[model samples]
Target: MCGIVAATAQRDVAPLLIAGLKALEYRGYDSAGLAVLDGGQIRRVRAKGKVREMEALYRADPFPGGTGIAHTRWATHGVPNEANAHPHVAGRVAIVHNGIIENYADLRARLQAGGRAFTSETDTEVIAALVDERLAAGLDLREAVLAVVRELEGAYAIAVIDRNAPGRVVGARRGAPLLVGLGIGENFLGSDAQALVQVTHRVIYLAEDDVVEITRESVRIHTLDGTPVERPVHESELSADAVERGEYRHYMQKEIFEQPRAVADTLEARLGPHGVLPNIFGAGGDELLAKVRGLHIVACGTSYHAGLVAKYWIEEYAHLPVGVEVASEYRYRDAVVPPDTLFVAISQSGETADTLAAMRESKRRGYLGTLAICNVPESSVVREADLRLMTRAGPEIGVASTKAFTTQLAALALLALQLAHQRGLDADRYAGLCAQLAHLPRAIEDALALEPAIVALAERFIPRQHALFLGRGVQYPVALEGALKLKEISYIHAEAYPAGELKHGPLALVDESMPVVAVAPGGPLLEKLKSNLQEVRARGGELIVFAEGEAGMDGNPARGALLRVASGGDFIAPAVFTVPLQLLAYHVAVLRGTDVDQPRNLAKSVTVE
Candidate 1:
């Protein structure tokens, strides 16, 4: 996980590069640096901490240049220090890189043997040395870059600049994402289109192993092996306002409240007059759903929880066998991919490293088709899939996902309805589910309105050290998600279990210091969940329940502790139930004085394995 921004423009581009790096800072902010080519030399400034530190250093003594490259690094090769930050320089070549170079040791040894010295403990410096050696050995800047790229042994998206070539910037991508931003009398490069959206909406997403060379006036693309290629410049639909916090205290809170709109946006096109059609997932989605023999849902983190929820919906409604797996474990294992199985990848940022890798593995193992339910239209996962469903959650900047997760559930619900329609489901049942889907936005709004109560619920947990969450059947994943949210933000040790499993093991951990939160959706399992809550009460544990209003525990003494969450329908109740849990975690984190947006040791996107 890292970020890169480069530009060659008609005027001083250092400010532009700084702004782009600041925008991409969510990707990673461990260390930041910039290299700008001025009158016949490359000047670089690197710092060990947040982007603001680099910004301060630059402001103290500015380095302005017409062409430059900047990076915010999530450290992989060495400790995050000035020496280990990006913008590593050798000879006249300066480079900023995102991915690991597997054979960096060998290349470093070769370069060192050739009398090339390295100043930083990074794989990027090795590339710089190799390119510098090539340039020294009678090759032009672009020629040296292409030559060195041919010998690279691992995934990397890099931007290189040569002092001799003052007006040019060379960029290459193999695995990590890279894109070019188009503008009049200027051109730009970034790890994602979001960084450049403020500068230009027109972008060309570079394919795997594509090398691009950009100048002040023109842009050219070539294959890694020197073959010229043409790539379409698509207009990015995300606006600068989407990434802003507006009046919200934090991006996470803004995203959490945006659930109502996010779910509505996701369901906007899917709910048509003829009930749920399959074309929402691009062309041939209906055909794929009809022919699918089984389904494998793959994702990581919050996306994995969404897939787990989908497993319940797909199997119950579509009546097909569905297996959900964490993308990290799924990619490494020799998973059984049944013939004609539709491999589904769910990710908020389609560039999630593990999820994308799992999707590629599914393709390699001959899955019938690959489907990606992702928010970003030009994400690597969407591009790799044969069928794609774009979740209209737009740009989710928070490290802890909120809107993205809810919108994914909406998309998955539509997919399940389409599959059920193909499997000859009863018309009344189909129409009911469609209406439930339509009601989700309003239900989520009602849940958001209950925030003041959830805030009070959160206050009770401020002194608690650990917690347990319980639910049965379809709501079990909701419990898991609740536990995940609590742990992610508030730094509380929380665990979730099926209500029945509390007696088997988890009950032992319940005590006065440990709180128990239950997701009690009014379902067939309601009585069983009530019994489980009684067990927690008997164990002298404080209980917090996110329950449906008509669950009929009306006169119970736990009413003070129980907060009612809205239900769109039994099918879409999970999305509504998610709101209170998210708010609880957010408010608790605020009270605990922890960083809600940038939690420690976590980056927004896991772009590296």
Candidate 2:
């Protein structure tokens, strides 16, 4: 369940729907399809891979309907095949859904027992069946959706069109994101603003339990219980140009190169000449920091790696004890929330299912308050959290996050600096950290300049099956992130270990067959890290070392590979080092002929558990 696009227009909406689905393609999907209510029947086109296939299919035999629903599905209940794709139809209804339907088995059994036949093996198909059953029971399209949603259990955002009704679309959201796009004598619905960016910039972000019906001329909203409601319309600043991959070969590469500008955008105005302005987290942010004695940062995937780095920064500078945990695991355990401990959830989309659940669980467990560090300003996490820090990463369409990860680091750094100042960090030291934040953009730009070297280095990783990454202290997380980048894009099996923990069973796997990539930055632990690299070299392991501006390797090893990242002291090296790693993965994937932007078996955001 990944992307959805539907529209009711005065003109032929097939091209508009196709364009919307194409815009959401970066979210990652294995199958794509769209169904238009043509004349009195549903016309369908389904393809197993890219949206181009379906678009071509539609071009050969066009169905000129003013209303349609489209989907790019990342298979949940079935395999990635055309038969399992969305725009699933049943009786009078055709639907596209994004999110899991937990009670589908129960509903499928009940429907089958009642003589309703099933086709595809998707939970989304069950939804189509349910909505069709309600429609057949004499309810209108909107009523059918409201009734079907109440009977359903699980997270979902569904858009439906009745074969009997023209110029209309019914949409409902319980967990996943859904919004209505307003236009002149036309309206649209999609999973996110990016999908609607081509046709409209104004939208209504649907709240949980919101059911909306949009036609060419009007929009109506209500709850599952039939109570009428009004949702605010938000004018989106997102543009179609932001998602285009201008000069880069792939979205992953483009986003990797965008880190410098993205980080600068994140830190813009958030830092003053002296230090962090503190109010960047929103109004009353300073008072919120004053009460915080500790932090519990919860996130997942690359965001979890960012949280780990933030723990190092906040503890080292603010003197605050920080506990970082993966969001999926944080809620499963009986947490011990210490007094004045702020619960922080970080996400690029800010709609990660596990992180949101953990944040909710934290409230019941009694934390000081919740803070959301997110990229999307209107996401659920930002709307629900007591405080917020928006990471201005723009739209990170690639599944293997590049600029988003670095921007999260940039945002978390500001959070750390603000807290450090509250702990009475020295003026000179504090100003130095601020100065480093200001220099991060140039440092990243320098790292991006290493692309040719990284491109040459990619040839080495293409033939490799596995990799080992190493770092020490703050850079340990950097190593983990580097390993993640390689494994994500190149599909190379990789692992990371603190340079201090190489002998703790990881050393046994080191050999000439396995390359060891190390983030060897100049710091107090540089000597220790160098010794660790020596151990890998002794084991005959090929070494790829990213040193800090020629400082870590004075007498360079003739047998090893070395690339330098522009250093900006110790405060912002993590974000800087991340650039080459992203470039490394992108180039490796390109050489290996892999899907660099939409990696296999991965989506941009984890909206489902």
Candidate 3:
């Protein structure tokens, strides 16, 4: 994923664009660039590093213009360098793009045949040159964009500004995220609302194949065929504080602690004192729930782990057969998504490339109903789905997700309870679980107090090159997420194994140098988890246990550290127990001197496959 921000007829927009880019830097930080229409010519500046570096470069050689487009790139087709940065310019056209053009090689060959030269080895540069070629052949900016898009085949959100049309910017999205911020006098375009939230909260989320022509005072929407279309502009209720880190050392840490507030927010206004969902989805819910034969939970990364936990919840409570698939793999497999099957996509950013693509495929295949559990209200996933469950985890700034994952679990758990009620499952059991769910925020607050101990534990393990995480049942997904967070930020060689699976193959790697983080929550699997911990301890592996406050350790001297979560009911423990693991990863990464906000080789959003 990359971040894009464009503004037309906005004087001194560079500073604003930079601020927006900084807000979006979590999405990408490999390189940053900006292109402004200056004196009827394109003026571009780029830096090979973070947004701050680009800001310094731009300040030294100011590219003053009223209309501009900026990008913070996550390297895809090329190395992370100034030459490979976005706002790729070709002749009079400058372009900033998110997503990949799969047919770029063929397009490059055809363009080379036409004697078009390329500078950077990026698929985005090909788009800029193609637009430039079309513009030279008597097509206007919008016409050229449409023509070029016709030749492309891939997911992309392209925003172009031509020197000849200094006041106009054309943006097109095909299976990628693009939003138009409805501001006074000056209009804005960004890959996400976070990029434009500071300037305007009113936005129009562009659908696939929708092209927007933005000028100083007006925004026109049209189909690829040039027919004018109407789109709804919605006001976002997101507050400025939602995006702030407050007093935490890093956004990751702040997000870890915000899990309590976020979970509370997701549960608010929907559930009553009796633990009933307030008929939110209405008639659609009944119709869909009645006919649903099975469910396909599609997501990527941490969201995928959430779906794993959801499978347990829904199957146990809702009595529904559920399959949790990695979105990227789900589309290509011979999986069955019947007409009455419910397709649920989980994503924090909502612009997750594979998840969005999988959702589209499910719709094309005629899934009964599509639902998106997302954090962003009007994100592509939310807009495309028939029903939306918005997680109230506001702007997750860390590249490796923390609060968003927990919030998604909280929302999905509630949805499971709702489904259980509709399906006439054990109502009392479901109600008890819901009551526990309601107390999760407070349990999470208590869990967050373990951070100081976790930070101390992290100091002993951050320097280790290899680590392993193990858990059983629902905690397996948390173990996977914990391992992922460590690998994502700290560059540690970490792997998660369902405790039972360790004996199959992974036990061979356990040694003195390997640190094993075991999620041994108090449950039926507690003894098995303890046995697994002992297996690691027998192999001279360091052990870190995440257990309840009263969990008995059986006097194992090998239990190097214990992160005791506050005592809570079993149903709420996942939400609360996840807090310490998130802090452990964050503190470890920070101690390793890694960029905690924008991790290397990772972007906040997975907008491209």
Per-candidate clash tally = 0, 0, 0
**Root mean square deviation (Cα) for candidate 1:** 1.8
Measured with C-alpha atoms, the lDDT of residue 286 in candidate 2 is: 88
Model 2 off-target regions past 4 Å?
549-558
Residues 518-538 of candidate 1: C-alpha lDDT, one tens digit per residue: 898888889888888888878
Please name the candidate that would achieve the greatest lDDT relative to the true structure.
Answer: 2
Q: Scored by CA lDDT, what does every candidate get?
A: 0.88, 0.89, 0.86
Worst 10 residues of 3 by lDDT: 549-558
Whole-structure CA lDDT of model 2: 0.89
Task: Extract clashing residue pairs from model 1.
Answer: none
Cα misplacement distance, residue 398 of candidate 1 (Å): 0.8
lDDT (Cα, tens digit) per residue for candidate 3, span 330-366 = 9897787665789999999888889988998887787
Listed in order, each prediction's TM-score against the native is 0.96, 0.98, 0.96
What candidate 1 gets wrong by more than 4 Å, as runs, is 549-560
Best by TM-score: 2
lDDT of 2 by residue, 263-370 (tens): 999999888887787588878888988999889999999999999999999999999999999999998999888899999999989889899889989989989999
